[model samples]
Target: MDMLLGVVVMLVKMAVVLGVALGLAAYMILLERKLLGRFQVRYGPNRVGYFGLLQPLADGLKMLLKEDIIPDGVDRRIFLVAPAVVAGTALAAFAVVPFGDGLTLFGHRVPQVVVDSNVGLLLVLALSSLAVYGLALGAWTSDNKYSLLGGIRGAAQMISYELALGLSLVPVVMHARSLSLSDIVAAQAGLPFALLEPVAFVIFIIGSLAETKRVPFDLPEAENELQAGFHTEYSGMRFALFFVGEYVNMVLLGAVTAIFFLGGWHGPFLPPIVWLALKVLAVPVFLIWTRASLPRLRYDQLMALGWKVLIPLALLNILVTGALLAAGV
Candidate 1:
């Protein structure tokens, strides 16, 4: 009965998280378009509903109703499965993220996370790495040279940045002495990791932007160059899946950043959950601002920044952190 109850609670948590995540991913698109319009001094998406509040709904409906075109002479099975892989991996990374402190309900204590594994960071990194497979396979199967080029660029960029991204967190883990994200958050009670390890924070932010394929690092989807990038051939709901996955990845990376650097669920004069939510929301806004302000980097520049600059800096940061820890700082 205890095990069964635990299973039920986990299921409930998963459902709630999935619903909120998907909803946020949809609405974030609306928010980005609206804000981008304001940034560029134009009105954006005010047609479907009042202030375009229903734009996401309308867009979703259109995707559902539109024809899903699997292009001729393509590998059908992998093409169909690729988007799901991307979306699923992105969503799954959230399972171990702690949104708040534990709660007491019906004389039982429940963790805020769906899965509280000790290696939660590893799980997230692994899932992120797996997302590349979908991109690569999708592009290869599409049989389009443009898509193939985009996929190659994406895979290379992500792989390069992943080194910096993973290494950037090592300082935090070293300070916290645990791979568990919750422990890392708790370690920041006195001072958030961002204050202690600003270099890591910067590297993580840059790497994260690359991971999400946002502006300045979005060579993979360079519309001027690759038409539509890896998902160029996809249409309808399949296209929507890739689109939604990007936003969801943004949200996930934001939460991870909040947890690891900004002190997750640790703020004064606000409930822990609310604090977490606000921090999570702030990241996407920053990302949008960046997209508005910065132009995309050339593919060579993108790769050079990740491999030559970010990765080296991340390694240096790790060494400095190790030295500090050895000195008992």
Candidate 2:
């Protein structure tokens, strides 16, 4: 009976987490548009509903009702599968993210996390790395020159930045002494890793910007050059899936940043869940602000920044952290 009960609970948690991820993804588009407009001195989507609150619902409905088109000579199977791969990986990575302290209901205590796996941090990195395949495959299968270039750029950029992104986490693991995200959060009860390892914190944020292909790092999908980049050939629901993948990735980066650096759900006074939600929302807004503020870098500059700057900085941080640990600092 305990086994059955556990299975049921897991299902419930999965359902809730998925619902939240998709729901937030749909609304994140609205939030980004709204914020981007404000940053550019304009009103955004205020017509769809009061204060534009119903815009996401309208947009989702439109996507569901649109016709899905397949370009000629494309690999139909991969074309269809790619977006799912991207969206699925983004949603799945949230499994190990803890949002609040455990709570007791009906005499049973339950963790706020979906899966408190010991290797949750590693799982997140692996899944993030996997998401790029969707971009590459979708672009390649589209058989469009624009998309093909996008695929090449996307793959190279992500692969290059991923090294720094992964390396930046070494200090977090060193400080926390655990790979589990929950354990890492608990380790920050007194002080967050961001304060302890600012170098890694900065490197992680910059690497994350590149990883998500945001703003200055968004060379793969440079609209002026690549004409919608990897998803240029995608239409209707397929395009919507890619859109979901990007927004969900933004949320994932925000959550991971909070969990590893800002002390996940660690603020005082407010509820833990509220604290996490605020932090999660903050990162996306910052990304939008960046999109408004920065110009896209030249492709060479993007590659050089990731490989020459972030990678070296992350390695130096790891060495310094190791030395500090050895010196009992």
Residue lDDT tens for model 1, 220-267: 889999999999999999999998889999899889999999999998
Candidate 1 lDDT score at position 160: 95
| Best-performing candidate as measured by lDDT | 1
TM-score of 2: 0.98
RMSD of each: 0.8, 1.0
lDDT of 2 by residue, 112-143 (tens): 87998999999999999999999999999999
lDDT of 1 at 262: 98
Q: In model 1, where do residues sit more than 4 Å from their true spots?
A: none
**Candidate 2 local Cα displacement, residue 90, angstroms:** 0.2
